[model samples]
Target chain A: MERPHNFSAGPCILPLEVFEKASQSVIDLDNSGLSILEISHRSTAFVGIIEKARELALQHLNLQDKGYKALFLQGGASMQFLMTAYNLLEKKAGYLDTGTWASNAIKEANNFGKTEVLASSKSSNYNYIPKDFLVPEGLDYLHYTSNNTIYGTQMKTFPKKENTPLVCDMSSDIFSRQLDYSQFDLIYAGAQKNMGPAGATLIVVKEDILGKVSRAIPSMMDYQLMIKKESMFNTPPVFSIYVSMLNLEWLSRNGGVPSIEKKNKAKADLIYSEIDRNPLFKGFTALEDRSMMNATFSLKDEQLGPKFDKLWKASHINGLNGHRSVGGYRASMYNALTLDSVKVLVDVMKNFEKTA
Target chain B: MERPHNFSAGPCILPLEVFEKASQSVIDLDNSGLSILEISHRSTAFVGIIEKARELALQHLNLQDKGYKALFLQGGASMQFLMTAYNLLEKKAGYLDTGTWASNAIKEANNFGKTEVLASSKSSNYNYIPKDFLVPEGLDYLHYTSNNTIYGTQMKTFPKKENTPLVCDMSSDIFSRQLDYSQFDLIYAGAQKNMGPAGATLIVVKEDILGKVSRAIPSMMDYQLMIKKESMFNTPPVFSIYVSMLNLEWLSRNGGVPSIEKKNKAKADLIYSEIDRNPLFKGFTALEDRSMMNATFSLKDEQLGPKFDKLWKASHINGLNGHRSVGGYRASMYNALTLDSVKVLVDVMKNFEKTA
Candidate 1:
């Protein structure tokens, strides 16, 4: 059977070639005659894998010469919520609570220091990005989420803050588009999204910005220690990191982030155009603030839900259903999502209208 | 090529059946047509995997009606080192410093509370388990490493501590043998040895002993919260957990721990008997404290090492090289290591002696 177009919010679609490579490695990695899952992390074969992975991440993100280090660590983005605070939040930090992930980041930051919310979109249930926000002076750092996974919103442009470090949670949109990757002092993304599997987190940190905190950070949560150890601080998520490396290799081979971004734009435009033209469907997010990765929409006639659902299912659409908080539809088109798949979804929407 | 006799200390051998299943899942799980890596962790299919993993862990350990909960967590046992202290260490804790792992656990515990080294085998370079130790009545808990991976020593008998909770880091040798597992109040193992991959940790805790500390525990590190959420507190190490579940299933099908223990004993005895008989090599650990999981040894004639190394390599004995500190050899015979492999190793030693 052909694999369906999976639009899961995360741990979502990955390149088919990457999956095949990962599957092969799980059986016998580098012909060492041991499952990648069974080999020691410190073995020469695995150490080369991790080194290559870190090198690939730095190279792909264009952070190799930018005084930044790419670390493939464990615990995902949620662990980073606390780790970022434990490392950087000394006196105070400013946060823009654009969505659920940003608010959660703010909550965790409050545990370490005075985290002032400079802007919040909760007033409108995060339907749009919070602009007209202050990037205050005297802050240790200004933090924000680049893309809101749950709310289907994104920051089109970043705010300019003078002399203040910027931190971004790019968990949902790390490699889906082209961006100036060197601007932020810190950036983190869970690998499950565009990177790889669910266990490892890809953290890009500027080397000079650490060790400013007075508190003794736990070894596991300390960024300085991880960077010092070159991300082998402990037994890393080996399988996760290996799979991520395979995905990174795949991305590099198929033209880097810029090429993928073009394909992503074409896919997103197809779905958004269908949502706008289709009489039976309406997008939930404001036009300017809509996410290219996740396009949230709802039916114009709520009673036709069963018909639309049947149509999409018959068309082999998986995870087209939206998040429970905004119950309608979410077509998440990450890097791995094909334009042809988007056409299928658009065709489903148009065919459903004719039937109605 | 067939998988070699992988004698890696941790991230060691697994059943061939587990590896095949894990490889298939990496491609497509349960015929979902989507790679397990590409599916949402929140999907019912994934949730069922975690549930079955927890259930199997409890069932295999005979803890079903024992008021204990099994958790498949991320960050490995290194994270548990600090978390164990955060949740349980209130004022004081007792530690048995058996080896590197035990000492590290004590070091982490000391950050949260006063930790007393109740016993230590470091005087002998941790080549033997300490027999004389007192579990004080006023301690919060007694922590120890069940198997010392580096030093190749294991505790055959545990001290009976009345009114004192027992915490065991069974990281390197959790399911390789049969033991009264319910004796431990908190048992944590990094699931690289005798289980599955490196990303997940197996933690079994007696439910009634949590929430005794005053500190606000970090969400990721809080055992009570993890128990409440059933270890889905965050995006878990899904690939690792699924592989661990498959390994556990294989263990259940292959006569469980008791049957595995019989085979493990046979393997260990085969290698040890050869070490005792062979004049070219000598075992490292004391006879009484010799580990069934890891058999550490060194060449009797150090100058004959090169020839012996060549012999083992020819015999397809992988990871027989001991830790750098030990500077010799380590034949780690975990559950998946067949007695036939041990016979092969023993045959290699005999052949090497004849050549010498």
Candidate 2:
């Protein structure tokens, strides 16, 4: 049976080759007569795997040898909401309120210190990105969500300010595009999105931004300690990191971020064009601030919902429904989502228009 | 090639059948046409998987319908060290420091509130369980390590005190032996040892013991919030939880904890008898407190290390080397480790004695 076109927002699709290689390793890693699950995190073999993953993550982001350390930590990006504050929020931090996750990051940071909302798109129901926001001086760091998965909005340009560090929760769109990677001092992404599976979170941080917080940080929440220990603070999510390493290797072999960016653009163009041309459908989010990773849209005729749902289901489309906050449909096109899958959805949309 | 006996401390061995099932599921889950890795946490399929894992965990511990909630959380047991204190430590807590991890637990708890050491075996290099520790009145909770992987010490009996909530970090020994699990108000274990893989941590908490502390806990660290959210406060480590559910199913099918305990005792007995009978070997921990899961022993003749190592390697033994704190051999016999593996190690030891 053919695999369906997976469009789940975050924890979405990964390359089929990664699943195959990871599945094989689960039984026997390199014919070592031991399952990858059984291998010790302290073993030289696992050490090489994690180190290679860290290297590849930086390489894909074009940030190698640029004073940044990549760590494969647990607890997902949600944990980073607190950990980023624990490690960096001493006096005050600035956050751009973009969507549900961005608001969550702000809430977690407020527990540590004063969090200033530098800008917000909440008034528009996060339909657009807040642009040309005034920069506040003396802030510890300016944080923002690079892409809002639920609202289907992405930051086309980032907040640039000297003397204030830039932090980003790029959980939904981290290796999907090429940008000025070094502009952000810290960037965290949950592995469920473009990386690999759910357990491990990739955190890339500049060495100098740490050791500035005054509060007593728990060892597990301390980034400096994790960096010093080479991300083996305590038995890392071994299988998650290993599979992530495999995915990173896949990303590298497929021409890194630049090549994938072009493909992502093509997938986005095909779907968004269909949404615009179809009379029965309308796109969610502002046209100028639309997300390339997740495109949210709705049927113009509410009564036609059942027909459209049946069509997508018959076409073997998975996770096409939008989030509860925005009731409609969402088509997530991650790096591993082939352009052919998007074409299938577009074909379904075109057929639905004639029948309706 | 024959599979080696894996005795690595944690992130250790699991059942072979679990590995096979998990490997197959990574490619296709229950004929769903979706790779398990790609499924959303909120999907009905994944919700069933996580709910089953939680139910199985409770059923194995005999804590079903007993006001205890089993949560498959992330960040390992290290995160629990702080989270336990964050949620339960109101004024002061008592701790029994048995090994490296217990001490770390105490250190993290101290950051929250006053922590009193009831007793410690650290003076003797943690070679014994500190017994008959005096329990003080008015303490919020009493915490101890159920099994010390590095020292090979197990608490054969727990400290019982009226009205004091008992918290145990059962990372290495959970489900390996049957105990009165209801006695402890809270228990947390990293899934790598005797559970499944190295990503998910199983946290079983008696609902009444929480919400007593005055300190505000971070959302990710807050147990009450996680319980309310059904462990889906954010994207959980889905693959790890699925594999854990598979392992728990394997455990349930194999007669749950009671039957595994008997097999564990048999393996422990086979190895401990050899350690005593062989002139070159001596046990690390006290005889009364020797852990059934891990047997730490060293050669009396330092020069025989090379010969013993070579014999074990030849006999397909893996992770036999002890931690650096105690430079010797540690044969970790987790739940999934077979008795045949124990016999292989014993045979290697007997051959080493004869050759030397």
DockQ of each candidate, alpha-carbon based: 0.77, 0.87
Q: Please tell me which predicted candidate would have the highest TM-score against the true structure.
A: 2
lDDT of 1 by residue, A213-305 (tens): 898887888898898888887788889999888888888999999899899889988999999999888998889998989999999888999
Q: Sort candidate 2 into its docking category.
A: high
In the predicted model 1, the residue pairs found to clash are none
Which one wins on DockQ? Answer: 2
Model 1, A341: alpha-carbon shift in Å?
1.0
Q: Write the per-residue lDDT of candidate 2 for residues B1-356, one digit (tens) a residue.
A: 68888988878888889989999988999999888999999999999999999999999999999999999999888999999999999889999999999999999998899999999988899999989779999999999899999999999888778999999999999988889999999999999998889999999999998898887788999999999999999999998899889999999899999999999999999999999999999999999999999899999988888878888998888999999998799999999999999998898888887888
Report lDDT (Cα) of residue B200, candidate 1. 91
Tens-digit lDDT string for candidate 2 (A1-356): 79999999968889999999999999999999888999999998899999999999999998999999999999888999999999999899999999999999999998999999988988878999999799888999999899999999999998678989999999999999999999999999999999989999999999999998778988999999999999987999998899899999999899989999999999999999999999999999989999999999999988999999999999999999999999999999999999999999999999999998
Model 2 C-alpha lDDT versus the unseen true structure: 0.93
What TM value does chain B of candidate 2 have? 0.99
Among all windows of 10 consecutive residues in model 2 chain B, the one with the lowest summed lDDT is B1-10
Estimate every model's Cα lDDT from 0 to 1.
0.88, 0.93
User: Model 1, stretches more than 4 Å misplaced?
Assistant: none
